[model samples]
Target: MSRRRSARPAPRPLRPAAERIVDKRDGQWFVRPITGATSVKTYTCPGCHAPITPATPHMVVWPVEKALLSADAIDERRHWHSACWTRRH
Candidate 1:
């Protein structure tokens, strides 16, 4: 008797260094590139007090540790201009 063949392909492996969240002395920051596939959203930059236009590449940052709840922290996340964020150092 002939053996039945598998129809599905093998699953791909996950990358070890694919994490986007970074832990610093202040808090945890999520870093990611704005891709064309993503829908854009407008945000005000805390550094420059200017609006971050949609479809523009930028950075999203939030504090990891806070007295408030996790939901509050997520809501408080800010989108910043790439240059503005870099100058914060």
Candidate 2:
């Protein structure tokens, strides 16, 4: 007997998190929080120089100026551990 496949709609992609501007001693930045549910890819945290594994909550940050004029702003963004980003001077 042949089995029939059931029809199911694909899961919708998560909407991007709301971004906030941060003022640091170095410069202004555009920051967004990444929730565990939406965190899929592994990334390196520049602050701690460690790997941010999938499903781990983190922060995505980039220079405001770079983000404003760059077409590849997403590529310039870095994923950082929440605590590390907070403690960074």
Q: Write the per-residue lDDT of candidate 1 for residues 1-89, one digit (tens) a residue.
A: 99988898888884433227776566677655454234277778898999888877777776655436555656666777878877775
**Poorest lDDT segment (10 consecutive residues) of candidate 1:** 30-39
lDDT digits (tens) for residues 40-87 of candidate 2: 999999998999999999999988775555786566888999999999
lDDT at position 21, candidate 2: 91
Task: Identify the leading candidate in terms of lDDT.
Answer: 2
Look at candidate 1 and tell me the lDDT of residue 15: 42
TM-scores of all predicted structures:
0.57, 0.77
How far residue 71's Cα lies from its native spot in candidate 2, in Å, is: 5.4
The Cα error of candidate 1 at residue 25, in Å, is 6.3
Q: Give the TM-score of candidate 2.
A: 0.77
Question: lDDT score, residue 16, model 2?
Answer: 74
> How many Å off is the CA of 74 in candidate 1?
1.6
Clashes of each: 0, 0
What is the model-wide C-alpha lDDT for candidate 1?
0.68
lDDT of each: 0.68, 0.90
